[model samples]
Target chain A: MTKITFKDAAGAARTVEAQDGSTVMETAIRNAVPGIEAECGGACACATCHVYVDDAWTEIVGKPSQMEEDMLDFAFEVRPSSRLSCQIKVAPNLDGLVVTTPAKQG
Target chain B: MTESIETDVAIIGAGPAGLFAVFELGLLDIKCHLIDILGKPGGQCSELYPEKPIYDIPGFPEVSAQGLVENLIKQIQPFNPVFHMGEMVERVESLGDAEHPKFRVTTDAGTEVTARCVLIAAGGGSFMPKKPPIPGIDAYEGRSVFYAVRKVEQFRGRRVTIVGGGDSALDWVLNLHPVAERITLIHRRDAFRAAPHSVNAMRELVAAGAMDFILGQVSGLKGEGGQLSALTLRKESGESVDIACDDMLPFFGLTMKLGPIADWGLNLHENLIPADTEKFETSTPGIFAIGDIITYPGKLKLILSGFHEGALAAQKIHRYVYPDKRLVFQYTTSSTSLQKKLGVG
Candidate 1:
């Protein structure tokens, strides 16, 4: 099990187990953490799973596709560091990954 | 004189369409920016469940909902796109014309972002589960009643009664049959609202004495010490009955709210933006809509359909951004170009 920390909209830190091959978004929703609503069901058709991926993981994280980028246009507070956590699966190297939820629950 | 970062395209909502956009646009070498309100991408699938198995999405055989997001995000990682989170788009600004409209994205926090293009992948809206308006309903959330269940393991050996009649309700009944000690399916009316096949299967199971069913309306709930105890029901004959159970599951329908975007007033009908179904463009120029949020000219709200619409919109955006690319390249890679540039090599 991989250890993943979720910083909810309230800045609450939640440590959860993310088994290998699981996305960070799954960890958050499974734990019932607030502010991480994946409204599109992982199809990347919705921007509800928006999160600020710690820039330090950029190498392990890589980048979003044109489709994901286009979907971000409809989100609330998109930033240079914003990433769809569902797009990123947890790897052994990402043991201590940190992700923050947007304050809004759209 | 300025080395400031400039964004070419900005996509909203990091669901399938958004993730695939990165794949499509990255092929064309068009850098873009991405944004979404949830802390993770994949919209409803990831937001709701990562462990829950899904059978509908194409190209997969019983894939976990979370599994799809991981693959999609990986597929689009080749293209580096910008990301924003915890932000709601307040408004979109224009640069006076469609050719060079400076897209100003304002957030609820008053932060502003500028991009050339914006894609609305916000999905079907924020879904709030609709429950039976029984007496003291809110008192049972997380105790006797639940808006959703992410873990089926929690209900092991527990007697669970599920309300409502839909795909989720029937599906949950089927999933929980082996896990729970006893399963009871409830609905408001005698006719089920779930898919015909699902309903048929459920009927078969109940008739064979595998599950229990009550054709009535929920009237009240009785619980103890933060744990669900029993359910009060009004039978179809107008008589009231009480059933003792360990848990109550209300598989009622979900209510989707478009959120603040609904206020934009894109000439909507029945909570959807009406547009040319093929174009996916909203009534207003420089502003488009897709996914379940759009309706017009015989349209069905489905995730795969949104993918097609989003691709079409991106191609249209590409054409709009490079209206003369065809004309410019008419003499570059075409037979005419070979004749003019290389003299028929």
Candidate 2:
């Protein structure tokens, strides 16, 4: 099982096992993590499920789609490393990725 | 990770979107924690315009927005959705073993909770508009400043100013004509943005002298201690005029936008979430966008579309989150059967 570590804005960390085919957001939501709103219900529309992709895995995580780029404009506290948690689909290759959820959600 | 509270699902907003989601989850026998900022469950239907009649919603010939919401709640009764109102969510966290897991949620009131999945269904409300900036207008809210009026039945026999260019503005003019001694319309634009028939009706009222157009914008509000007596208007040519009235209804359309969600930069096209319509997934992984909030190629943001989005997103989520569930959308309807029923086979 792949392991994904989720960190909150307050620096609290919780790790969940990323099943073979599920994305990190799915794993986190199924686990009931605090700090990830996922308002769009995983769609990029609501950036409630915001996180900083483990920098080590940036190159592996391809760029977001144009629609995501547009949606991110509506998110809070955008940063160079800011990524919507819904966008990152998990695969066997991503074994020990770290991610963080944003505190505020609309 | 060490200490966690668990729930099947945690929903926010309790609006049409959130409520519908709970109903969908109930079909799978999943439990939920539904939260809303309002004191009641119907979201805007119960809070914003409880008495206002609504058209364009499918299924019911016609009903008040409140009535429709109530009906929906009753129709989805099989779901047995739980309710938590007057609460706001501030955080989300995840925990558990790989196969079976749990999630934790924190609220603004400092309550820590958990859920397996989070669904946000906050409907079309972000912020409500306040009184437009008018000269000397700061003092007369209780005496004159009203955010919204539920029933216009009592406004008869009073002087009124309806300051908007939308459908409600026009409707108000018609609704209040019989009762108001004087009705004036003050708009920022020369043309009305409301439906053509409503606009025409208001124009007919103007021609009939039931209402008059002031041809300017309200600049300020001026009144004595607690009584509103006059309005300050700014003309297109920088002129100011004062009009006397007992009530003012600014019909200028309100602007809507996403709130704190805008803080996180997700790939967006227009204000809608750019998602793969087929998958109902956004640029963000693990997160799926649904309803009117998502738009992509050949997509429309309507209630129908949102319904489809919610249903589709759930399927995708179920598969992504519950690999063991192994669900699929199998249907019995076929083109051949449809053709045979129509005698086209």
Candidate 3:
């Protein structure tokens, strides 16, 4: 199990233990973490699961793929660290991965 | 005013479930008219991911989303189902009492369908444009900000700013270039998600200095009383630039909403209609719900499950459309009448 923390826009953080194969978006949804609405159910078709990776974890989390970058065009208030949380897979290497959900998702 | 259509059944969506329901209802000699908000037949299949592969469909190892929709369309072709595309069902009025249940369905495009039974196969409600999260942006909607371009004349002599990197943004940038005094295309990154040809054309315009292509996102909107004046663009380097514009068009894609379905007076279980397992009928008699928009014990939101629910719903619908006739369940494999209805006898 990998520990993942999801921070809301208001700075409230909720950490949950996620399965190795599951995604960060799935973990946030399973825990009912506020501000993360995965409307497309992890298909990466919609950009409703936009999140900002914590600066310290950027290198470990890596950048989004080309397809995910294309879908990010639909998200609001995108930044350099923006990622569609569904595309980020959880693993042992990402034991302490932290991401912040956007104020509003497209 | 156009005359209202009279049919034995009115299917509310053109997705896989509603299309299959046409075939099932057709086997029982019921004519149907399908109403969909999208201009095309396939709902999310065509809209969201048409090229994506679906593996769970029986008899086929793998089929594309659009391919499944095409096959379903072909399967129901013999029924000659009339389609009212690019229209949303605005109201569903129950015309008859409990004994003889009937409904008069109306759409936003002024199309009316009066049928003996109404089938709600609307998977995930209706697809609506996703609004940008810019604060106070709603105040400028329909006045100085627009999601769709119904009229090209509206942008004439105006400074227009088109945001997004998708087809809608690039297409409109090219289309409105001639009409608008100046066109500014804004995107977060330099890379575009639109067709290569459209991207090249936009780049050519930028090279010629005919239009402005900025690499940034719209952070705020400056407007008053539904009139947009300028938009604040924030660059990746934390630089904010205010571009003066009279109109702004953001081409963010679509999202699903449970619009108008909540107003139909049906019992909703967390935005989904609660239906019985046997007939797939809703709390209201003669009104059936199926597909992802329905909720029941052990209900799965799979395409195959929807097909099964539609088949059972047709059996119950036969009773409503043909009240005096006895329904005899038959299979197309051996029943000559069923084969004849399929046009394969």
Q: Each candidate: what lDDT?
A: 0.70, 0.64, 0.93
- Candidate 2 per-residue C-alpha lDDT over B1-345 given as tens digits, one digit per residue, 9 for 90 to 100: 123345666766676666676655555446666766566787655654566666666775678867877876875566566676665555555464434445566665566667655555555534344345454555676456655565676576778888776677777877778778988887754666568898898888888876788777676776677566878887766788999988887643332345433433446666667777666655544345565556678876455566666666666556545658856443324555333433445
Query: In model 1, which runs have C-alpha deviations exceeding 4 angstroms?
Result: A1-106, B1-5, B126-255, B327-345
RMSD of each: 22.3, 18.9, 1.8
Lowest summed lDDT over 10 consecutive residues: which window, candidate 2 chain B? Answer: B252-261
Q: Candidate 2, which CAPRI tier?
A: incorrect
Q: Clashing residue pairs in candidate 3, if any?
A: none
TM-score per candidate for chain A alone: 0.90, 0.89, 0.97
Q: Could you tell me the lDDT of residue B24 within candidate 2?
A: 58
Docking class of 1: incorrect
What's the lDDT of the predicted structure labeled candidate 2? 0.64
Residue-level lDDT tens digits of model 3 in B168-240: 9999999999999999999989999999999999999999999999999898999789999899989888899
* Candidate 3 structure lDDT: 0.93
Per-prediction TM-score to the true structure, in the order listed: 0.45, 0.43, 0.95
The per-residue C-alpha lDDT of model 1 at residue B34 equals 65
Residue-level lDDT of model 3, residues A3-105, one tens digit each, is 9999999999988999998999998899999888888778889998899999999998999999999999999988889999999999999999989999998
lDDT of 1 by residue, B84-135 (tens): 6555566666653656545666655455666666667676764455555566
